[model samples]
Target: MRLNSLVKPLLITGFMLAGTAQAAPDAREVLEASPVDDIVAQYPEMMSRGIQDGLKQSGQVPPMVADSIGFLVSNSFRAADIEQRVVANLEAALTPEQLEEVHGWYQTPVAGKIAEAEIAASAPAAWPEIRSRAEDLNKRYQGTAREKLFDRFDAASRATESAVDTTIAVQLGLGTAMAALSRDSVHHEKMRERLESQRPALRGMVGQQVYDGYLFTYRDISNQEMNLYLDFLESEAGRSFTRVVTNSVQQAVIEPVESIGARLAAFGNFGGE
Candidate 1:
């Protein structure tokens, strides 16, 4: 009996140690294990869509000109470039333990399911359906636990913030292009100030879009699953993971956009052939 008792305690201790012995994942490994690659792959297209919408709102850009601008924006915001930035930023922002925690979370079954929905939502193909059903989805989920949960989840994931940042970046790109064509000064700082001034308004507008997207993407996921997902997102590691990834993506796209004036000038010379 004594031997069995001693063995039981030893086994418990060993298991505890094993649990604490999880290896810290490298940035690349963490990213590879998550839905980041697929998501990043869709970013160029997403940015292009945003740029096109912005162009349309201007009510002055010709359809062909807008298409050309969209093409440039899409090509410039490459997935590989964004991945590189993500890796670099994650390495800087996440501690080893945080990295391991994030990697572990991404390996969960719930994470995989959520990733699937997110990946589908981010694709250009899903945009039409999401838009068409936006009103219906909003009405269906209004005043529900799921709706409240999604609002919290969106805050945790910085969805609205990232969308706003992307919008600002697109605006910056457009401004640079126009400056190059008009031989006007590229007042980047002033442009950023103007964009920053509009952030509050942008946030309000984008928050609704983000919420609608959440309703559409997570329609298949049960409340329990969403709660589980939200629990993780609200966790320290998940918050860090989301913040780093979103900032990295924004920086990557913005960097390329900054240098796009020259390329855009060349494209314009060709009449956006």
Candidate 2:
């Protein structure tokens, strides 16, 4: 997913918050029933443009070749079958009753609308406006009770998939991908040390991105609507589903890194003739 970590990792609650099981569903079934596909399916287009702009900034590749690689990379990264793995993991970690409840939320008219806004807001195009609006939202809601409630949701989201952890993980993912390309120079230990050195800047960058995304996701929805949504998330089943879903998505993010890195590293094999 490039370095963006496409899934927003909002309101994470582990199974510890959920009640005991009511027969777990198969992961695939849960995934098919969930809104995860709608949430994630928009990423490839956003990532393609991001990669294209990045390639242009580097000024190393011809336009045609850059576009070609951009196209290839976007599809390759996304077509990694990550969604199935994520849903499967969520199924394993959560109770069937919990999954059903979460699935029900995803099917609701409000959730569907919210998901559409989120899918749109998550694009790179929305970041600038989102950041600007986030400033306004923070100020507009200041000292109000709703603002306090917003803070709780934000806090939980941050705790579950923190900017620091996101930064570290992303830095590592990039380093590992680079390492796969450099057999001798990119050892795992050294890469970790180097990434650690870059943490402070990455941390700040991730924080801004996350803050903007939160505002963007809920922009059109009212505080009352948000309150209702948050109430659901705060429930026992909601918390449990969130925990598993967050873990599943995180695992899905990393599952393809090494394999894809190795393939990129093996480019010489394709042209040694």
Q: Which numbered prediction scores highest in lDDT against the true structure?
A: 1
After aligning candidate 2 to the native by TM-score, how far in Å is the CA of 201 from where it should be?
A: 3.9
lDDT of 2 by residue, 6-28 (tens): 33332123343353344444556
TM-score of each: 0.82, 0.68
- State the TM-score for model 1: 0.82
Q: Quote the lDDT for 153 in model 2.
A: 71
Clash count in backbone of candidate 2 = 2
Model 2 residue runs over 4 Å out of place are 1-34, 47-69, 78-80, 124-150, 158-167, 176-186, 268-273
* Candidate 2 residue-wise lDDT at 265: 51
Per-residue lDDT over 197-270 for candidate 1, one digit per residue giving the tens place of the 0 to 100 score: 99999888988889889999999999999988888889998899889998888788777766675577565556
lDDT score, candidate 2: 0.61
lDDT of 2 at 261: 43
The candidate scoring highest on TM-score is 1
Determine which window of 10 residues in candidate 1 has minimal summed lDDT.
264-273
